[model samples]
Target chain A: MAATRALGPAPSKTPDKPTDAAGQAPRRRPRAWRWADIAEFAGSAASALLLTWLIFDRFLPFRIQGVAFFVAWYALTLPIYWLVVRDGHGPVAARDRLASVLVTTGAAVALSPIFLVVGYVTYRGWSVIDFGFLAETMELTGPLSGADDGGLLHSLIGTLEQLGIATLIAVPLGVLTAVYLSEISGPLARPTRLVADAMTALPSIVAGLFVYSIVVIRTGWGFSGFAGSLALTILMLPTVTIAAEQVLRVVPGSLREAALALGSPYWRSVLLVVLPTARAGLATAVILGMARVVGETAPVLLTVGGTNILNVNPFSDYQDNIPLFVFNQIRSSKESFVDRAWGGALLLLALVLVLFVLARLAGGAGPGRRSRRKKGAAK
Target chain B: MTTQESEAPVTGQPVGGTLRGVGVSAWFGARKVLEGVDIDMRAGVVTALIGPSGCGKSTFLRILNRMHELVPIATLGGSVLLDGDDIYGTALPITEVRRRIGMVFQKPNPFPAMTIGDNVMAGLRLTGRKTANREQLIEESLRRAGLWNEVRNRLGAPAGGLSGGQQQRLCIARSLAVRPDVLLMDEPCSALDPTSTRRIEETILELKDQLTIVIVTHNMQQAQRVSEHCAFFLAAEDEPGRVVEQGETEHIFGSPEDPRTADYVNGRFG
Candidate 1:
């Protein structure tokens, strides 16, 4: 059987290959378009639209329009499209086109909510945000005051300081814990990993309560930015640790082995070679951790008693952040307060967006991203 | 190719150290990979270990530099000696053992994040050893690895930008910068094109005078072309790898004591 198989015609010699139909040269590129495809799409869309309109307006007893009309049209479009494409092309092409459409639709559906939230916030808050709004504070403003009278300057400062303190405390500890988990396989690694995994799932409110009990109630530190920072730290630690560990784990074992073979002690290899190799990934991890805790309202609300005045000292005094400001202002039954709350929400969204952009920039062309050298054909 | 025009002789004195393995056995967890292997790799000559896949050639090469121990469950028996001192003994630190006996893997592995110059100088920085002139040392190492002129102007370029062959040579220069007494290569040319493989073979020949070179290769012609001495390793089905024969390259290829060695050299069953 082996000899017969080996003696038989080679696979390349076979004449029935789809790519070489009628002995013609194979077309390397996939034909993405045809005149019939456009016709099929147009026909499917028009027929679906007409059918939905007739069903809503004429065929059905009740009249439906607006979003429901479009939703009905969309629902009817898929099968119509499949039928049209199947007739025009084949079952394979029809299936491929349907899959592409479904995937694209799913992506659009997933992204729509984010767009709606951002658009709504921008529309409501665009008129309120200005140079003065950013520069001024709400120290003198009251619930009766106009929306234009007070700004989120105090809240912004509190957010920045609290995040700053939280980052300082959490990032180092988290990164060190990550190093222990990923690089060193000591006895505590399993238990430490378990704790960090559990902490990642810990509710934001629980983190706030833990800090509230330990730092605010027990230590009598009172409701301050420091306490808020501690709560944020508790929330941010597991995030940074897990992410940093993931980043560290990807620093190729070959690189570490190369370092060791070069006579580097293990710690030195990890410190100089392994850490530097994973710098961009580590930065991204930190940014992810920051994003995780940036919009946390419960922790800020529970630890830092909301205040109106701009307080830069995170160590003392009640301070308010953007989320807390939004939470408190939105609950009030005042138009101006609601507008201010929308403005705060917009600011928080903008901050998170900025952080994501920064993460992209930091992670994009990391230290030896492909050759940037324009000259010399060494190859 | 352009770099070879300026045939600047490598500056460093030949400091090759004789290496000897006595009854070296290895196990990965409970599975025995190699058993009672003995070989002598003389200084200032290229010694090639030719074997089939899974015959423990690479494993033995890694054992020379103490890289074998990096695997968590890997265990070793017997001793490897460099210049008549037990490398596995506590007399020398593990880092020191690795430094003296360098390694080049099958695939080129320069630190992707580092610049070309930095990659060459990585050994110095990693080992925390200082030099009088950093620029001079970098140039010297690159020159010895036969990669100087091609990369001379772009020393600051990221190492990741280099071609596969250039990267391999850069790894060689990185290893050479540490000035190791013995260099162990585990099929260093297997990942390269024919031109790159030839270039690496030429490099191995050139570097032979400056360091004791021990290479593991499945390619018989490569072993014949580069090595002065050769050891043929073999393993039967479900058996641990062991040295079948050892002699000069000429004798091994011409008239081997073991028929298996003859078969392997003549392109029979690996």
Candidate 2:
């Protein structure tokens, strides 16, 4: 046909594309750090030192002489890229290369602190952590001793129970409130949104004080795990509500319209269609909210009043969480206590990493549509 | 190889219905879209609603089935009758009105998470018609929409994995699953390739014996090809839209009564 004639044969992309596909090209060499990379990095670093020398001697009073140089190096990259890359790759490619470099540098600078903290703690904490540190209680040993003296087992149980109660309280309330805000149209939507936004910024200490006054003083229960969990619930509700609301809002309008056209009532459509579509996002919200509050020492210290002995009854007695355990260990003036504090920090890091991995798995499969590979993995 | 002509035996008898709108006008918030529009879509015939862009042909189609009212700011000043009974009568539920009158959108919108077979069964399940055999219903609906042969082997695959044309046909199959009396389509083939468009057109012509259909389209030649009855809508310079002419498709295209209709059909102006 005329249309087929108009299409004709396609133009080749790269000269060797077809040959490469046919296995005509030679095998590739193993990659290595090459000579060109040295010029790029050396140029970037020298620019930083030169800018620091230019600025610190003349500009201002403050002695930001050390940090200013390292940061100034990033800004000096534009001129270097424009000078070194423009003639070879033209203006557009040169600009793209410069932008990529700037973004990569920014990412490296931002991530350095996280790596530094994990590295430092891992180095110090390895000595204290062992089979004994994981399974025993601090009740048996003195402040000055080896890994045989104490353990995080007691703290682990307290953290789990408190967080369980907190999850039990916050998840339903947050999901329901999000549904009301996103699905139902009513007079109370705006005011409820305002209140949730306000609560997200509520200081952890204030939540602890509020729970202390309302539950601790009224019931005369001094410091129980229940009170600590109540404070955690207060801190967690806003995060879950706001995130779940955002997820629910972006579920495409076409989907609801499709369900409605099938003669579904509003509530049934939301339950069957809208909620299922947002299932993964809702799981992410719960995990993130849990992570946000799990490291709180201020609220737990204020309410749960740290215990050294093993306790299981959250309803009746004081308990210890890892943050409170680490705080107490550091407060003691023994070298052994500092090592134990680092060991507790390492455990907390592992727990957080586990939560992130769980979140990634849950977030992998699309709410309604899963990749065949993901489905195979699930099976 | 076409899903048509095979005629799976889900329906005990063929079905269709009539729709009539009287003095219907619509508004979105403060802006009036349609003014004093009247139309009758009869059973067992294809009625094409045609106009230039923004002439309210699509709005009129949505209004016939009460979908316009779902918009938060939209208000309708009209009465629509389904087989002589007012759809707005307080005794009839909105759910019943919608179930009896089904629709296909401008774009293919199969539920992405659902399989092809499940997409066919969605309307039946949602509308509480569980007495029908689920397997027969899916097969008959896909056959009616002319998609059964291409997809018979992969019915359990996600509907989203199908190509655009197949997805559109799957949507048609989905709408047909409920066995509605009337089916409304909004520019069903505008987003498809020419081959898919021809296939959907053939399906439309074949489906005329079973359901009343009102299709909104901007393609004039397509209107001439698939429809029997044609209604032309037009609006001038910020004015509300209204029908200019209506009659048999052959007559409308050959010798229009109105100057505007003739100009539009002849491609002189929109």
Query: For each candidate, what is the lDDT?
Result: 0.88, 0.83
Best by DockQ: 1
Scoring each candidate complex against the real one, what DockQ results? 0.52, 0.36
What tens digits encode model 1's per-residue C-alpha lDDT throughout A235-297? 999999999999999989999999999999988999989988988888898999999999999
* Candidate 1, superposed: residue stretches over 4 Å from native: A1-55, A58-71, A75-104, A368-379, B1-14
Q: If you assessed candidate 1 against the hidden native complex, which CAPRI class would it receive?
A: medium
Task: Give, for candidate 1 chain A, the lowest lDDT window spanning 10 residues.
Answer: A1-10
Query: What is candidate 1's lDDT per residue for B1-270, written digit by digit as tens?
Result: 534623545554665999999999999999999999999999999999998999999988999999999999999998999999999998989989999999998899999888898899999999998899999888888888888878999997889889999999999999989989999999999999999999889888888888899999988999999999999999889888999999899999999989899988998887
Task: Return the lDDT, model 2, position B193.
Answer: 95
True-vs-predicted CA distance for residue A216, candidate 1, Å: 0.7
Query: Alpha-carbon error at B120 in model 2, in Å?
Result: 2.2
| Pairs of residues clashing in candidate 2 | none
Candidate 2 chain A vs. true chain A: TM-score? 0.78
User: After aligning candidate 2 to the native by TM-score, how far in Å is the CA of A48 from where it should be?
Assistant: 8.7
